[model samples]
Target chain A: MKTLLITLTIALASLSALAQGVKVGDKAPDFNLKNVDGKMVALSDYKDAKGAVVIFTCNHCPYAQAYEQRIIDLHKTYAAKGYPVIAINPNDPAVQPQDSYELMQQRAKDKGYSFAYLFDEGQLVYPKYGATKTPHVYLIQKRGADFMVEYIGTIDDNYKDAAAVKEKYLADAIDALIKGDKPTLVNTKAIGCSIKVKK
Target chain B: MKRFVIYMLLVAAVAASCTRGERPTGELAVPIVDYSGLEPYLNKSNDTTYIVNFWATWCTPCVEELPYLEKLSREYSNGPVKVLLVNLDFPKYYDSRLLPFLKEHDITAQVIMLDDSDTNTWINKISPEWQGSIPATVIYRGTKRQFFERAFTYEELVEIVEEF
Candidate 1:
């Protein structure tokens, strides 16, 4: 019976590893990544902010490109409100040369991105957040000592058209947290370009 | 003389219809579909092994692997396997972009357009492992099924499908 119990525990542990990344209600992992402006940025840097909008986006993805203006608008709308957008390029530059750090700076400059576009140099942070695709978003609310993952998923209901979007999942989640209430919907999904990783 | 004119008109109509039968270069008839329409194909049980690959034109890696997928589709034509190329391109751009891109690429495999908007609902339902990203694939023969969420080379794709 003891041996059987040990085997079961091992199996469960491996299963959790296979599941990958933090689930709902799990504390968000903190990371220090180089921003486009050549400064290292981390979640803890926004200590006074109510929440953070961490989006795994890249320079090459058309879906990410489509939502670029919307993401910029999100930052312009919410930055002063204390929910700053933190864009990260989680794709491997080896796999996708367009997403290289030098190109990221150029893109940010050309687009006039108000937010800090960070480079996940070794591609470590995204897997911890369970981000499988470019433009995957995670809305985190700062609690006493840890950042609580309030919402995980897409920026809005529509990726094809920003004008026709009825449901703003990311904005709604942030709004709820600012009002000191839990978001009604904590998760959503959209079709996005899978993160390019080297074979 | 009037009867002869009528006969000539009929012949011209028949000739036009025959020439029109030829598609615009490499264009294939790709139907736009929702989950209800696609669910039947995925769940239907049969001896024929169905290799359904979910992809889009904008997805770089997916486009990179297309030639390999097409080659495999051609190779397995004689076997009990059918490659269904399910494109998840945005519905609005079907005519302007997706169809033209299909024609340009000369995609010979049977292509179907997936027009579902609520990806969160269907991605998980397709396979719990899917996090709504492309290009993913589902291969099935009868009740046995396998889901892969990674890119494949020509050799790798053939090996996986052959085992199925």
Candidate 2:
């Protein structure tokens, strides 16, 4: 019985640790990383703005690639109002053959991204945001001086078929914030490639 | 001179052995079938509960939850419960990832790589709310199947396995 208790404890602890990933109501982690332009960017940099859209992304991962255009559209639509999409690459190029700095630049330049494409070298920022996959998005809204994640989830309900899109989770969340209302679906799931880290 | 030659040959032998690639393929990797394809593998009379975990090599939570799933499989082996892992590692993870990953860990449950094109057709086909999330699981007993997202604990797993 004692052994079983210990096993149970270990299992719970492990799950708890593994599940450190934040949910909808969790506070967004603060981070500062060098963007593609070699300029330092921080979550606080956007403090003066109404809110920010924090997204984990990379050069590889077909799933992430699939949302690239949609993400661009989101930034184009919302940056003027308040929320600016901050795309962060969480993969360590040292481990991921496809996520090298050079490839990232090529991808960004080719895609004509207007948002900040920061590199999370060593993945110091991803875990804090509780991000699990590429293209994972967290919407942070600035209430007073602090920021909290308002909506966390997929870009939209349609990655497979944009023509058949029925729901727009991120877009709706931003719209809710604009209307001074909290988003209804704050936490949603995204399917994408895993972020690779170097040992 | 004789001793030096012997040492060189021994070093050469060691290097050759070390470089000889992953273990000889043991059990053939099971293919992750679509919802329609899953019909053949499932026994209709099986009142025994079955947990089918959908995972991939690149997915952190999926990889992390493997051992716990293995334990669940072990527990079920003693009774009318079963666990099957559907690996979404895809074909890309085979050489650069899966084979090496399998060799590094001691895995006991059956592992399958689901190679399906056009995820759109299958996402809803598997379950309406899948949302393409990895580390999701589908638990079944007879005609009933309960789907769960997120990783599992041994106790939580046991509870689900024994529920039916």
Candidate 3:
């Protein structure tokens, strides 16, 4: 009975760990996802960089589409500042055909995307990051050899009109990190389309 | 006799036009509310079970699972189960997108548009577990409440409602 109880406890602990994804201050897991350029991209690839602004987004979601230009602008403005945008589409093509890898490549090319628009093929990465929706931002800062999640949530306060946005949550966090000061507002929420995963 | 028949047809056409004019244009007058206005619907001290679903017109899974929610409402039309659809479509799309979709689908349940921009503050109030994803649902009755951050089929929805 004692042996059985110990085994059961271990099993339960592992199960919960697998279920729960990375939270703020947690060491963000590295992934080798395929980029739109037909090359494998990994977090370690940006070893010399200060941090990365990881966004889990897709082509089909209107919310994601609305933030496309803003995401591009974020990369353009911050890439040289040591915090670049790493976009990964975590949707399953079987569930949402529009988010297929072929279309991601097409979208990147059409938009003249300077950053790597990666495909989290096999739907493996987003769940690990606890990304429940598209356009979910995970601002991970480089802490020695590990990338620690500093901020998580929406790109800004308003998802409707960019011009009218009052609070730039992701950008503000990046700016704070760059200035060597901790971000005052670390987390935020926004209405977004749920990430597509094949059942 | 031919002239008399023509007169009767003209009378019937005029009557049809009048009835059409009397009927409401498929546009439903849904209340657009902020988080504060929506809070009361989330918490009602009544005996009825409120199955409130947060969805948008653009969300594919949310759209797919809507029929099941509608069916649940129909099944318990006179019962204690009440289905409330909380639409999260952007305010601008309310007229151009949301209203047309609701009208086209003939959604019979009570629907209210959530126009609150401050989601970070209100999302936790709805449920701390909610990651601000659509197709989320909250089933509550008086003080007893449960939140689900997932889509449901008709049978699954019925099973959960039964448990409540």
- Highest lDDT: which candidate? 3
Please give the distance, in angstroms, between residue B9's alpha carbon in candidate 1 and its true position after superposition: 27
Q: Mind giving the per-residue lDDT tens digits that candidate 3 earns over A120-160? A: 98888887898889989999999999999999999988777
Give stretches of model 1 more than 4 Å off: A1-19, B1-28, B91-105
**TM-score of the first chain of model 3:** 0.91
TM-score of each model, in listed order: 0.84, 0.63, 0.88
DockQ of each model vs. true complex: 0.54, 0.14, 0.64
Residue A154 of model 1 has an lDDT of 91
Compared with the true structure, all predictions reach lDDT values of 0.88, 0.77, 0.91
Give me the TM-scores for chain A across all models, comma-separated: 0.92, 0.91, 0.91
Please give the interface root mean square deviation for model 3, in Å: 1.0
Candidate 2, DockQ to 2 decimals?
0.14
Query: What's the TM-score, to 2 decimals, of chain B in model 1?
Result: 0.80
User: Can you write out model 1's per-residue Cα lDDT over B1-164, one digit (the tens) per residue?
Assistant: 99999999999999998865444555448876788778888986878888899998888888988888888889988777788999987776777778778889888999999887667678877888777789999999888989988778999988987877
Model 3 misplaced stretches (Cα beyond 4 Å) = A1-19, B1-28
Better of 1 and 3 by TM-score: 3
Residue A179 lDDT in candidate 3 = 97
DockQ of predicted candidate 1: 0.54
